[model samples]
Target: MMKAGPSQEEIRRHNLGALLRFVHVRGPASRAILAENLGLNRSTIMALTSDLTAAGLVREELPRTPGRRAGRPSLVVRPESTRVYVLAFDVGVDRLTVARVGLGGVILDRREAARGRVAASGGASGAADPNEMVNALAAAARSLVRKAGDEATCVGAALAFPGIVRRSDDQVMFGPNLDVGGMAIGEVLSRRLGLGVPVAVCNDANLGAIAEHERGAGVGVNDLIYLHGDVGVGGGIITGGRLLGGEDGYGGEIGHMVVNPGGRRCACGSRGCLEAEVGERTLLDLAGRQESPDVPGREAVRAVVDAAARGDVVARDALHRVGTWLGRGVADLVNIFNPGMVIFGGTLRDVYLGAAAQIRSEVATGALAASRERVKLRTAALGDDTTLVGAAEFAFADVLADPVQVLARLRGAPASAPVP
Candidate 1:
């Protein structure tokens, strides 16, 4: 038998979700603009906007300026930033950040804490205790939720982990920087919050790519690559304006790409991986500085950059070496993906700014002439907030996918209930 097509209700729901997603990503738009962009009639656009407004996901208001030749200014539909919020968490090797982000990508409030390594017992490994890390993150998230006031509604939550995350069940598969591999972090966080909203766990680099594509340097660029640096290197690839999550969501582990054969060993049990060749620890070691208990890794990297700015030959040389290796790795990616842009984020942003000349020189020599000319290499525009914003976006994915149903659930109403 031939398959049945979607019903009218299903089509309505899909159009509603598409309209909300467009406004959420592209900001406020007039009804005519929405109709044009979504290829829907004016009446259908009005219906969708009205439903979204009643669901507390959007609001319509008169344009700020009156049109010179119009009967009345077109109403602008905007995401309801004040009423709805998403909690975003960024888990790094040495730090944890929790943020309450509103619908329009505004960070309403945030909290941060240091993540110190768990004390080693007799012959015990010094990796961070997964339980302790979860507890600290839960506490921070709870604090932010409380600070948001009881009147505010949390639509969803997402955690950006510095590791490989299984998309099917939000299981942490591998965390070289964290000790939470195989942990059900999303389930644990949801239980800790005691909130009905489900929490999501995703790779930090993936989130970074989302944030960059939506609001940072990758904006308007369809195909791009985002490389994030923390304790280890990670990557996010965007193709055709969508994140390129491989099957099982385990793709984009660029750090493991071999850069130096038979060189230094990596934490992932690989020799001469890209991360091993150019990660923060290697940079510190090359700068003749040891990781201090008091100084954060990012701060330590900044110290090296600061020293280089002050004409320190050792610091400059260290950055150059790392940049050269980074460039070589990037060259391979360019030849393979041929992206229009390559963004360096996190600590790599500072590293790129410090050694742009060297990186560019290596790319010039290593990458194909046509590919090199088409790609733009730059630092992250969102600064330290890229992953946080990405977490928020990930949290909103469900809501954006099924706007009417998600809103009904949030409102404690039946899916078929009419907007009141």
Candidate 2:
């Protein structure tokens, strides 16, 4: 007997989702454009748009730029940014951000807090206490949600954590920066918020890469590498327009790659790791700045950059040394991945802009000539919001994957009940 094929209803739902996703990613587009892009007839596109509009996932508006000699302006379809939202969280070693983002990657509202990297006993380590971090994050999330008002429908929540997150469950496998290893972060945050929605935890750098690829420096580039810096360095790799997450989602831990043998101790209990050699702490220490709560991590990095700009020999020399190490790491990555672009984000953006010459020199010397000649090095265009935007994109994954079913579930659920 022949196998059964998908029902017509299934096909319609799939087409609806495809249209919604295209509009969401590519921005508001006309029905004619949508029909042409999706290879559907005008009638099919019209039906899909009607269904989506009735579902409240999208809105049809007159085009902002109408064509000349137009009779009636064609309506453009756009994601309903005000009504539907997603909670995006970024957990860094010294910073925490929570944002309410709308369907079309619009940031509706946001809240941010600076976290102290001291142990409960006031030790000088840069690792955040797990309990304290989680509590603070929960509080921030609550505040953001409350501020978003009850009328908004939250589709999902995604957290960008600076660590190796287990794919099986959103567990923190190893986080030298946040000190939250072996914790079920997603489950805890989900229960705390009581939103009844999926709370996803992903590597911070991976999210940064996603945000950059979609809207920032990597926009038009298929193969790219994103390197993020906070208390420790992390990397995100993208190949062929897809995130290259390894088995169990622990792939982009480039910070832990051994660069120098027996150089400095790393939080991962390894000696001479890339992060150990060139992370924020090392850069500050080399620049002769004392680590203290009085100076925030971002501020300290800024101080170094400022000093370098003022021609401070100590700061300039320190940045040069760090840049050389950073370049060595980049050279290895270039040889391995042969990416078309490499984006330096977070604190690394400052470092790269400050020491671009040294970094370029090392890459030119160490990387393969062919790969080096074709690659472009750029700073993150999204500035500090790259990871936060990435978190928003991550939250939208479920909604985009099965738009019809997910929206149906949302519409059917009680208004008082959080999205499940």
Candidate 3:
């Protein structure tokens, strides 16, 4: 709501905030375009841009991409190079991946560590100790922060887990693979790492969906579903351009959605869950006569996918079977939401190279005519980097909201008098 009479100072600050947000989300913009986009007068744009420049949050540069030559091509304004970078941690069962990201979705560096965890009860289903993994992850994050150098103004981290996440607060409500039912990831990591940055934790699949929607295949669409096909089948739903965290932040657990009345037992203690049916382990089993002694489940599936792409009929058939299951699961989403697109991401998409065509074919055949027309199926364009990038985006948003306060916290400064 617009205030009846906003003071000139307030209006200027509001306009500057809006302009910064636009640049942060959409990258660089020329003064003419920004003025037109914000519907602000040229003088206002000039003033706001100058203030941002003084804050070291915005800068001007010649256009990076080619453009029309109309009177010297005015410089474009963008977030400054010294703006803080977001740390993204994409946690998986067998690997812990990290990326240092800046505004505009640029990844400065990325690395991965082994997922050797101290499991519970000596069962394969149980992953490494949650506390142990968190410690290691925090250390890695600290090292990365140092590596990012002093220019990293603030940090925003999102940990992608295979579990139910609480929406109102970023907590791992439950994660089967981690062998922990409820975990407060945000609180623990913040204390241990002391990076002085806000942390946002969420399900890996949901982040995958976010990454897809923001920069990958689902871009320009308002409503979509992104499915992660890897060690397990997971899903994230976006409706009206927002990630629907649901009542429990577990709304997109489509992998656990029953595809068959009676099927394989899922690790989550359910029978016939989609994850049980067509997860990476299941796909690997169907791909080869027997599991290779030396290869892990994910690698085995990748091998088969490589074989399939090289013209192996049996491997192709296996991939098609997984694709068929994918389509079956997507059909349910279409029936309910009628999203504009369904993006398939993660290891499954990599394994099933032609899987999108198969899912599309089945959806066209099985889904309602209107829903089918509304949805277009495709694989993720960002590949496995989707979750990491999405987490980075989440972090950037968090930092930009209250940069001064966050920076104070990061630098161990006491807050001044509260706003009355």
Candidate 4:
């Protein structure tokens, strides 16, 4: 038997989601702009906007611009930023960040702390103690939620994890730096936070690409690569305006891409991986700081770059070598993907800033002319918050997709969910 088409109610829900997503990403937009962009008639747009407005997801207002045009002004539809929010968690190698991100892509509050590397007992270095980690994250998230107070609604929570996450279930497949692999961190954190929302977990690099594409330097550029550096390197690739998540959601493991045969051993036990060559340890080792305890956070990477800027030969040379390797790896990706932009983020942002010349030179020599011609290399515009913002976007996905129903579900949540 043939499947039936979508009912009118389903279509309305879709349109509602589309309209909300547009306004959420593009900020306040006029009804006419919404109608034009959504390919909906003016009356339909008005109806949709009215529904969202009544649902407290959006509100219509006069245009902020002064002076009238030839026709009646299209009222602007604005997301209810203050009233709606999500908890965005960024689990980096050096630190953990939790944020209260409002509906209109605004981060209203956040808590960040230096988080030392974790090592699960009786397991390979990457296996995690889920309970301990969740307790820590919950402690910070508690303060954030408390600050949000009673007026706001937290619709969901999302985490940007550094390692490979099994997309189907948000399972951490490998993250040696945090020892979080093979743990149900999402479910654990949800239980700890007791927020009554499923905590969504995804690869950090993928989220970084999403944030940059939507709100950072990659804006307006569809095909782009975002390379993030933490304890190790990670990547998020976007192509034709969509994330290139291969089957099983493990496609963009660019860090493990073998860049140098028989070179340094990677954390994944692979030899000569891009991450092994250009990651934090390699940079510090090249700069002669390998003997020291792994300095917490990006401080170690930033210190090297700072020294390089101060004319320290060792530091400068370290940056140049790492940047070259980074460039070579980038060139290979560029050749394969032919992206319009390549964004350097996390510790890579500092590395890119210090050795931009060397990185550019390597890219020039290694990449095909046609492919390299228009590719823009730049640091993440969101600075330290790229992945954090992306986490918020992920958390907000359900609400943006089906505003009315999502709100209904959230509203239906038991009021006895316990007080903060």
Return the top candidate by TM-score: 2
| Residue pairs clashing, model 2 | none
* Local accuracy of candidate 3 as per-residue lDDT tens digits, 243-285: 9877778898998998876888887888878888788767766
Question: Alpha carbon lDDT of residue 116, candidate 1?
Answer: 71
lDDT by residue (1-420, candidate 1, tens digit) is: 998999999999899989998888899999999999999999999999999988889999986667787486778999988778898999987788999998888898898988674321223233266777778778887778778786667889999999998889989988866767477988888878766788899999999999999989999999999999987899999989989989999888899999899977898998999999899989999999987646778898989988987899999999999999999999999988899999999999999999888888888998999888889998899998889899999998888888878867776832231111
TM-score of 2: 0.94
Candidate 2 lDDT trough over 10 residues, lowest sum: 119-128
Off by over 4 Å in 2: 1-7, 65-70, 119-129, 415-420
Off by over 4 Å in 4: 1-3, 63-74, 118-129, 290-294, 415-420
When 1 and 2 are scored with TM-score, the better candidate is 2
Candidate 3, which segments miss by more than 4 Å at Cα? 1-14, 64-70, 117-127, 289-297, 311-314, 402-420
Per-residue alpha-carbon lDDT of candidate 2 for residues 1-420, written as tens digits (9 for 90 to 100):
998999999889789879988887789999999999999999999999998888889989987777797498888999998878889999877778989999888898888888767642347554355766678778877787787777667789999999889888888888766667477888777778877677999999999999999989998899999999988899999999999988899987889988888989998898989899889999989999887676778779988988998999999999999999999999999999999999999999999998898899999999999988899999999999999999999999887777767877866776443322
* Total clashes for model 2: 0
Per candidate, the number of residue pairs that clash is 0, 0, 2, 0
> How does each model score on lDDT?
0.87, 0.87, 0.75, 0.87
Cα lDDT for residue 35, candidate 2: 94
Prediction 1 global C-alpha lDDT: 0.87
Question: TM-scores across all candidates?
Answer: 0.93, 0.94, 0.88, 0.93
